[model samples]
Target: MRITKIRATPVAVPYRTDETWAFGSRSGMVSVLVELDTDEGIVGLGEAAAYPSAEIVLSVLKSVERLVVGADPFRIEQLIQRIDVVGTWHHVKATSPAIAAVEAACWDIVGKACGQPLVNLFGGRFRDSVEFFYYVAAPDPDTVKAEGTRATAAGFTTCYLKVGSDSLDIDIERVAALRDGIGPHMNIRIDANEAWTAGTALRAVRAMLPYGLELVEQPVSGRNLQQLAYVRGRMDVPMLANEACWTRYDQLSVIHNGAADVLSVDNQMDGGLLNLKRSAGLCAAAGMTVLKHSLGELGVALAAATHVIAATPNFRHANQAYGALLSDDIVDGFGGGVDNYRDGCLDVPTGPGIGVALDPDRVARYARLYREHGDTEFSFQHPRALTTGLALPKH
Candidate 1:
């Protein structure tokens, strides 16, 4: 089927506000939803991270229409390369979510055309359902303890906490509260999102040893791979690499340096679903495990991640924001509401393609939220630093 048209809309997905946020508050969350239409009556959907500039991503996606429109949707691999070639002629970079969304849509079309799920495009399902770690918002120690307690009661086996941006003592207290509230059986992970210096990060992580945190993510800056290796060498717990690594090239550096024990892969950040799987394969070959990284859910990207994780054997539990923590989303069922995480596991959609159907009206409503409010809330990598009275860790 030939791609007839490409469309992108900016949407503002609402999350917890400042009053409820733990680490730092994000006032808004901006994302872009991409829809590709083909002549054969097949429509493919994709979501881009759209950090720093969702409007820029919208423009970027539309600017590459020449390379995608009228091209065979089946020629996905070739088209991915063609985006770079076409954009170079105009001095524009199309390799971001612009090209990634198109690439993902093409894959969705392929799966739908073949009358099979996206997992079938890979070998098959490793397990019937993929497990998920309960994502707690950026909240206070008491708030975190409550979230952990609720997570344990809900039957979630693992919980991922958003930490950092406070004093090492406060962060530790948050960890201690969670451990005390949830008991000994549950697995707890801390996500710093690159908020501390190497030395301070190592110190903070070491202090939390008594609480039994499963792993600490991106403790230091992404650029500090050597320091990361240094910390991992000293600490026994597996360190998960998030911002430091997105592709296999970055994975190679971390793996070669013995930096991180686990590799976290995100379809949005890594470019596409196939790209994430390819990176997971690279990590597997190197004898390292991959974690399906969800910086946050944009709905469409989460659906893509679920399919990719279902086929990927390297990761046991994928991380994403779901349940009541997130107030609004572009999709009604796939990322939140009925199809969201239940008891720490999300069932794979058995329908054709990625098993998600987008609601255009809802998409338009969120798109209006973006157009009117212009929320600058992006990814955790570039979170707005807290410079007030709170004792944020010094890098």
Candidate 2:
């Protein structure tokens, strides 16, 4: 059926705690929720993470309205091709989240029409449930330890922490505290987010080796594959490529250069759910593991990616999610807080399409929240952070 209309709503959902990273901090998640209404009276849902900003995502949706409207929802590839080629959004990475939201909505419509879940259409169930890591917000050593204890108590097997702070000594202390809190059983994964030089990465990782890291993510910049490979060769811990592999083309280069043992893939960053599956297949061919990377998504986006991750093989490790941090969600019973997870895993929704429906009350609440405070509170660029100069490689 043809798409009749597209409605895009920007929502800001508060986090339990501020998500502090190497560059900046955001108090919550800001997403552009997309709804595609079809001629056959079918409506599909999609969610786009406000990558750079909600304004950009809204502008992208407006720009592609002509390309998306009056298009066949079933012919997703063709529709995406038009948006990429005809709309000239192919080269712009920032436009991807909006494009991906449209594509995901189309897939949702297709699944509903076929009376099948997205996992079945993608390749059936390689797994019944998808595992996700508990996100530990970087704070003081004691707070980090407390978060680790909370994650462990919640039955999560893996915990993800952001490193590459202003001081390596502080990062080391935090890691040590997390290890102490989680005890010896659980895994600790750290993401530097391309905040260190190769030399500094080596020194920093070496210092934290005693705490036992599961994987070190993007210790150096993603631009230089040789530098990544250099760090990978010298370190015993496995490396996960994040910024280095945003697209399939980047994934190919990472494979060729042996830049990482695992790759981080995101449909929001690339194009859509289909490309996310393609990313997994590409990494599988290279005998490398891949995990989903989040730009802070809510239930709609989380459920869409869950369907793909559950159906795909080689996603052996726990993927990333904002479960530990999201204070609430717009969707009803899935993917908001730690309560929704069973030992760090989310059961795939068995309903047709993406299978998670939005709660109108919560949606309106968060939508109003977005309108009132999205610019200041939910922003990725903190006002204080803008005044301070950021020198990369944190040496």
Candidate 3:
């Protein structure tokens, strides 16, 4: 069936707490929810984490309308090709989330038409449930410890915390607290988000070694693979690449450089679910493991990625999610808070298509929230960032 219409809604869902990273902080998630209507009366759902901004994503959707409308939903690859090559979106990496949303919606339509779940269509279930890490927002040592304790008590095996504070001493203290709170059994993973130089990364990682890190993520800039390799070679803890590997081309470079022990892949960043699977295969061929990265997504996006992750092997590490931080979700009953997780894993939805439907009430509520406060409150550009500027290579 042909796609008849594309409906895009930007929503703002509040976080339980502000998600603070090295660059800035955001109080919640801003996502452009997409609904594709087909001639057969089938509707498909997709979600795009308003990476960069909602304005850009909305503009992208508008620009691709001619290319997407009247397209066959089942022919995802060809449709995406038109959006990429014909629409000239291939040259713009920032347009990925919008393009990915459309592609995901098409996949949802295909799954519904075939009366199959996306996991079955992709490769069937290699796993029944996918594991996700508990995100512990870095605020202070006490808060980090408390979040760690909560994560451990919730039966989460891995606890992820953001490092690269203004001082390495503070990072060390926070890591120490997380270790102390989680005790010796659980794993603690830290992401620096490309905030350090090679020398600083080496020094910083070495200092935190006593606390026992499971992995260090993008301690140095993703642009310089050699620097990443330098830091990775000196460290015992495995290095996980993030910014360095946004696409398959980037993944190839990382593999060639031997820059990381693990690669972070995002369907939104790369293109769509198919590309995400392709990314896993690329890494698998290189004898490397990959994990799904998040730009902060809600249930719709989370469920879409879950289907792909379930059907794929070699996703050995617990993937990233905003469940710990998301106060609520627009979807009915999937992937909002820690309560939805059992032993830190989300059960694969058995329903046709993506298997989760949006809650109209919640959607309207969050949509109103988006209209009222999305720019100032939900924005990634923290006021502190505007004033102080980004301090890289914090020594």
Candidate 4:
């Protein structure tokens, strides 16, 4: 069926707690949701990790919204290429949230057309569920211990602690205390957010080695692949490439160059679900693994990531966090809900088309923050009245 309309709305959702990483302290999250309408009464949905100042996301949507409003949603790959060609003409950001929005919306429509989850349509399933790692926001040893204890008590078995922002000695003490509090059985990973240099990364990894850390993410700056390789070669635990890598090209550079042991693929930041799958294949080809990266994505992208990781044998557990941590969302916050995570594992959603639906009321409420009090919310009227010219016969 031909796509008849494309609309994008930005929303502001407060965070449950201020998450402090090397980047900065985040008090709220900004996201853009895309809705695609088709001739055959189908609606596709997508979400992106939006920042207030991200001109790319805004421009990408504004540029493509009207053009795709009368095209065939079923031809998703072709549509993506059209986006690329247009982006080349305009020279917008490569991985804009708007691109992610359109891609995700196309997936939603395609999944619904096939009566499958997005992953099943892509390659079928290799896993039924994915495990989550808790990101504890603490700056000191005591706070780290307390947060780790709370997470453990809440049944989270894998936890990600932020490092590389404080002094080496403070980070060492925090890691030691967290590992001790979580017990030896719990898996602990650390995210530096590209704050450390090669020397500091080596030193920090060495100091934290005895705690049985699962991985150290973005240990060194993203730009210096040589230094990343140097640190990766010397580190006791696997070095996870987060910000340093995004696409198949990036993954290949790291793998062939021996810069990383594991690749963290953030679907939103990298491109979209399809790009993430490509990155996973590249990593698998190089005898490496993929960890679904996090970029403060909402439930739509999280659900997509779950399906993608579950379908790929080469992908390990995803770094899907924030659902339980975000105070607001379009869909019911998938994780952090009672059944969202149980015993460290999350059950795959069984509903069709990414297994989630947006809350129109919440969408309306949050859209006001970005647009006129009522202008940005996606209403049934918008999709219902979309004029889809004759194309393929309605199913």
Candidate 5:
């Protein structure tokens, strides 16, 4: 069916995670819900990650709405090309993030029309479900251990911890405490969020060697592949290129320079699944692993990631921990999908489209929150916090 109408609405979803995010952590996410209506009366839904800057995402969605008003939802490539043309014509670097929502919605439409799940479109399923790591939010070793055990009881297999942006000694102790509390069997990974210098990363990673960390994510800035390669060389631990590999060019550069062992990518960072597939392909060609990242999103992003993860053979380890963190999701109990997570893994959706529906009442409530409360909080934290536990400083 040909496209007839396109609508974008902003929704604010408040959520808390076990671990604090490294860069300007916020209690809620600002996401744009995109709806595409076709001539056949089928509707598709998609969510865009809009954080730190909602206005920019909303503005870009408006621009895209004009471009996609009359286009066919199934003609994803042409629609994507039209976006590229818009970006080139208007010099809009913000094109991809905006397109993320629209593109996902288009995928939803296609899935519904075919009466099959999105994963089926991605070459059937390599797996029935996906895995997710438990994010440890408690800072002190005792608390970390208690929660880590509790998370294990709840079904998580791995633990993801966030490190301070600066100071080697501080992060080393933090990791040591976690290792001591969680014991040896649990897998651990740290996300530094581009907080450290290469020197600090090398020194700190070396110190954390005894803790058995699986990988360190974005230890230094994403700008230089040379520095990442340097850190990877000095430390025995593998590095996951997160912020450094936002685009295909960035991923290609990291591969060319031999910067990282795994690629930590997601729909939000790379724009959408359209580009994420390409990123995964590049990582696969390089024999690298792909781990999906979360923006503390609601169910829509979670479902989309699940389909991608289930369909991808190169996806290693766990994806985002949405089930553990969110007190509630916009579509938690809706008809299509809320994602089935048991024992630290998520089931792939077998329904049509992205396999989820938007609850109008829920969306309305979130939109009201977006209009009233706006962004709840944003902050940075002490890198070397210990017994007192790390507290993020507001921005």
Candidate 6:
């Protein structure tokens, strides 16, 4: 059916608590909800990442609404090409993050129309369940050790701890404590959030060697692949490219430079599932492993990632802890998703279109928050910005 109307609405979601990482602290999430209305009266929903409320919402809506107004929403690839042509014609480079939302929503529409799972359309499932690694947020070694132990005990095969805030020695001690607590079997990963210099990363990795870290993520920075490659060459530990590989071109650079052993392809930042598929293909060709990164998205993105991972044989591990971590989730009770620990693996839902329904009340609650508060507490200006967790300043 032809798309008759395209509407973008911004929503603000408050964080239960302030979230802190090496980069910055965030109080809430800004998201833009995309509604694609067709002549047949079918409505499709999609979310975009990297939107800081106002800016990201405006960018995505402007780029997508114009091209998709009168076209057949079923022809997803054709829409992608039109975007490319228009973007290229106008010499635009920052629209991929926004375009991802449109592409994602179209997939949802297709899945809904066919009455089949999105995974079935692309390719059949390879595994019924996916192995997941919990991202530990505690800052201290004792706490890290406790959480690491808890995660392992909770049936998680791996735990990713955030570092780069403390000194290298402190970070090493924390990882060691986690290793000591969890013993030899559980995999331990560290994320520096790109807080280190090349020299610091080398020293940190060397010091952390005894703990058997699976990989160090974004240790030095992603801005310079040459320097990243330099760090990767010297370290025995594998490096995971997170921010460095945002798109196909960046991923190509990572592969060409031999910069990372593992690539963290964020579904949102990497242009959703279709873009991620392309990125995964490139990684496979180069004998690199793909690990889906976490962007605090709800179960929808997580479900989509599971489908993509199932399609890719070379994904070493999946980082999908938010579904279990969120205090109150809209889709938690709808599908047969496992929130509890389950022998270190999460079973993928075999249903269609992300396999979960959004709670209408939850959506309305967020919509109310945005309309009433206007994103002041969350520092967001529009709905899409909240989804990215960018925490923009309020006007």
Candidate 3 ranges beyond 4 A from true positions: none
Which tens-of-lDDT digit does each residue in 1-395 have in candidate 6?
87887776655566544445565545555555666788887677676543444465566677567788888877887887887776552243344546666777777778888887777766767766677776666657787787777776677778777777656777888898899778898888888878888888888888888889888898877988999999999999888998898677788999988889888776676556787888888898998888787665554556666776776677777564553334354455421223543765656666656565666787778667767764555442333333543432110
The positional error of residue 251 in candidate 4, measured at the CA in angstroms, is 1.1
lDDT of 3 by residue, 303-362 (tens): 999999999999999999999999999886677799999999999988889999999999
**Worst window of 10 by summed lDDT in candidate 3:** 386-395
lDDT of 3 at 356: 91
Candidate 4 shows a clash count of 1
Residue 245: error of model 6 in Å? 1.0
* Cα lDDT tens digits for candidate 5, 243-292: 88767777898999999999877677666777777878889998998888
RMSD of each: 3.2, 0.9, 0.9, 9.9, 4.4, 4.7
lDDT of 1 by residue, 1-395 (tens): 79999878878766653322223456556667788999999998877766546766777776788888999988887787777665752233223655567777887888889888887787688877777777666457888788788788877888887776566788888889899778998998888877777777778878898889788888877787888888778776789998788666788898888899888876665567778889889899988888887545566777777777888888754455554356667765656532366777777777777778778788888788777765544333224534332544444
Model 1 is weakest, by summed lDDT over 10 consecutive residues, at 380-389
lDDT score, candidate 3, position 305: 96
Q: What are the runs in model 4 whose C-alpha is more than 4 Å off? A: 51-55, 89-94, 333-339, 369-395
What TM-score do all the candidates reach, one by one? Answer: 0.90, 0.98, 0.98, 0.88, 0.89, 0.86
Question: In model 4, what lDDT does residue 118 have?
Answer: 74
- lDDT winner between 3 and 4, please give it: 3
**Between the candidate structures 2 and 6, which one is better when assessed by TM-score?**
2
Q: What is the lDDT of residue 385 in candidate 1?
A: 34
lDDT winner, 2 or 4: 2
Instruction: Give the number of colliding residue pairs in candidate 6.
Output: 18
lDDT, candidates in the order shown: 0.73, 0.92, 0.92, 0.73, 0.73, 0.69
Clashing pairs in 5: 18-137, 19-137, 111-353, 112-353, 155-344
